[model samples]
Target: MPAVTVDNILTLPRIETPALTAVDRPVRTVTTAPTGYEGEGFPVHRAFAGIDMGALDPFIHMDQMGEINYAPGEPKGTPWHPHRGFETVTYMIDGIMEHQDSNGGGGTIGGGDTQWMTAGGGILHIETPPEHLVMSGGLFHGVQLWVNLPRSDKMAAPRYQDITGNKVALLSSQDGGALVRVIAGEVAAHQGPGSTYTPIALSHTTIAPGASLTLPWNPEYNALVYVLAGQGTVGVERRPIRSGQTVVFGKGDTLTVAAADTQDSRSQSLEVFVMGGKPLREPVAMAGPFVMNTRAEVIEAFEDFQAGRLGSIPAAHESL
Candidate 1:
């Protein structure tokens, strides 16, 4: 279990914003920004669904899901970018990604790999592929989530965590399907990695074909679910979800999901992300590449980067 006492990150926020103030509490669906698929900075899906961590801390947007297909010798990756006052949790389910950051963090993350970065003050990072890594059509799938840092720790130092498969604890249901984790909290018997950020539970779960599972939530936090593969029937309000879809629940007591019939019995499973903390009811003014409570803070973030006030990245990157 997470020894999440209030003292962990006191500067973040207190339970106030009803949206993420508590877990399992009933949550109403609210419309937020940065939704839709981006083939190249353009929207395809009318409304790209994102998870809003209800009544919880730091969790801002759940890029619910993304699938990138790469052709032979074709390059596809994220370049250097900066983020202040938040965190990014990238979970890889298929293919591989080479991660390099300005904080001197470098590694290659493969399927079932997770890279967690805390962009406290600020940081720049890039992700590329290795040579001969993918010749044919390689599948790149996963979720890139944005978690808002609490007000108090907005200026704290930055941090990073990379968790690979096998190292992660796994707890499965009797049928050997439907695995649960503590990744950030206590779920069943499995416990996830420890972190400087407490009171935050990140759950990574999967259900076998024709299996049903109900993820536990603390009305004391906010939660959301994204379907990785196969068909899933989510019953937050008797809702149904297909592959590549995300179901977000706000202020709800419980988040429920079941796998629908899959082709070839597909051995299917869904990766669900459950996150919540005290809601920061303060005003959120977000623009491209930045998120802050006010426009002035946003200006400062952008200006600092342009003036070289925030400099640490290598002058040149060694491509893979």
Candidate 2:
């Protein structure tokens, strides 16, 4: 989905094949994401549904926001909301979204762009399709990932980072059979642009039919691979997986995925979102919008939000 691409993958840096000593991660579980609607009635796939919180430590939630083609006047986005104790990473593969926050962070991001907002302590923000996009709707596809902050940094000051597509590190599989777009963290000693409060690696990979990609992964981090489009097999055992499915990998130093020899006409290749992070290994208490370490803290967050302690909508965006 056009997050980023090169005319010739062979021109990009390649991820070296794992050494013979590298341990191959085995597939732990493969779960299918259920379809749902998100803000303003936009379609979404609850990418993290049914996955254990412990297995997703450092990652709280994830949503695959539409591969739908919206008709004119049909684009939708989230209303103003408050968040704390985590960061929200919005990566747009297509279409446009405008974001504004109470902390004086605002911007417009389009295809291949990413908005990284750390709602530490607390902040109010809203995401909406740009006016023009709403008036003349088109394809809209993206992913929003909720990354948990360590207890110590849960109350850190808020920050924002606008990472454009060109800023992402682009690499190719050892045989140039796949394109890997690194959005954050290091891949084969090559680092992406986004800074993270938690140690993590996030990448969107496209594998051509019949191709296999083996990625060197951090032994200490837990790995997950979510299929965005087409079909593929995961792990060393080569378990079959398709769109809307997610694979949680067991401990290992390398992760592998291979595309099927054929795919549906709608998707010519297998597209996957791969992410991993060092486990927080701490208690988690979450409410509707706030993630915290205790239920009492979650209640306190709601109280603060209602009391205007989080933040108020900016004057210019009051009409939104």
Q: Which candidate ranks first by TM-score, i.e. highest?
A: 2
Return the TM-score for each candidate structure: 0.77, 0.99
CA-lDDT, candidates in order:
0.59, 0.94
Worst 10 residues of 1 by lDDT: 1-10
lDDT for 210 (candidate 2):
98
Over the stretch 142-194, how does candidate 2's per-residue lDDT look in tens digits? 99999999999999999999999999999999898999999999877789999
Error of 1 at 83 (Å): 1.4
Q: Model 2: how far is 303 from its true place, Å? A: 0.8
What stretches of model 1 exceed 4 Å from their correct place? 1-57, 64-66, 134-137, 194-198, 250-253, 263-267, 318-320
> Which tens-of-lDDT digit does each residue in 1-320 have in candidate 1?
11111232223222121234324433244333344653234122222344343433456665633355567865456667777877778766666777777787768877667788887777777766665565564666666666776677776687888877655655555454466544555443345673635356676666666776655556655555555556666664546665555555665555666766562243335545555455566666666666777899989989988876554568667442
What's the CA error at residue 237 for candidate 1, in Å? 5.5
**Candidate 1 TM-score, C-alpha based:** 0.77
Candidate 2 lDDT (Cα, 0 to 1):
0.94
In candidate 2, where is summed lDDT lowest over 10 consecutive residues? 311-320
